[model samples]
Target: MALFRWGHSWDAFHDLEREVDRLLQSVNLSLSFQGLRFGRQYPPVNLYELPTEYLITAELPGVKSEELELTIANGVLSMTGRHISPEGAAEERFRRQERPRGVWQRSISLPDRVKSDNLSAEFVNGILKIHLPKADEVKPRQIPVAFGT
Candidate 1:
């Protein structure tokens, strides 16, 4: 009888170990999937700046010009937009989706004083362009210096 009892206890321990192993495997799989999703969600953006103006361009294929909103406040420029997926496209079937969709916002600090009222934005093809003109005081000017001997 003692031998039979030991055999039953051993089976119970083995079953418990298998359950724990399965739970651990599921957790690891979930973490891996999350990491992959995050990597494909956010891509890099390019910004350009000149001596008198600031220019920003973003790749937004299939996004309409009217969908984007640009604003400047307190020396910061913010760009917000949404990219609608193509019609009849199945989102779940995509093998790789690097382009970000939904409402996205990017804010950058102005390199110089900018005339927010005169800012302009245009979208052509797949590029979204922004033009920010510098304020009068921030523009470079030549000043004559006199030396008194």
Candidate 2:
């Protein structure tokens, strides 16, 4: 009876493993599950709206300025960059790798209209900061009400 019980437990374990494999396949992230993905669209970002301008920041470590590009049009901002892998270590095996490499692009819509030509970008300590000035018509204005005499 003990041997039969062991066989049943093994079947249950195999069933669970097959279910997990099916789930991973359904999501189409089997490479992510196996840790073999070379480039992933990642690198978190932050966006903030100031009184007169919008501030955008992105974390892009180990990326060069020449490899990055930025574009703004029709209230939409786009950023593209390449995260190059390290040199001479391509043959080395990795036990655990999480950093994303290769080209990545991200586009975000601005909350308000912005003056695309009047913008500035700065990269400091692996952080890219962008300042986009709001359009004149989009800036808030105070309206005064006058009582009829």
Which structure among the candidates has the greatest TM-score? 2
Q: Model 1, range 1-149, lDDT digits (tens) per residue?
A: 01112245478676665565556555554333322232232223456887767887777777787887778899997777787877787979888765556787777777778889989888789787888887898776799999999
Off by over 4 Å in 2: 1-41, 93-96, 142-149
For candidate 2, the per-residue lDDT at 148 reads: 100
Q: Using lDDT, give the best candidate's number.
A: 2
**C-alpha positional error of residue 149 in candidate 1 after TM-score superposition, expressed in Å:** 12
Error at 130, model 1, angstroms: 0.6
In candidate 2, position 45 carries an lDDT of 69
Ten residues in a row with the worst lDDT in model 2?
A: 1-10
Prediction RMSDs, each to the true structure: 17.0, 11.7
Looking at model 2, how many pairs of residues clash?
0
lDDT of 2 by residue, 6-80 (tens): 244478676665566556556666356232332333556678888889999888877778999999888788899
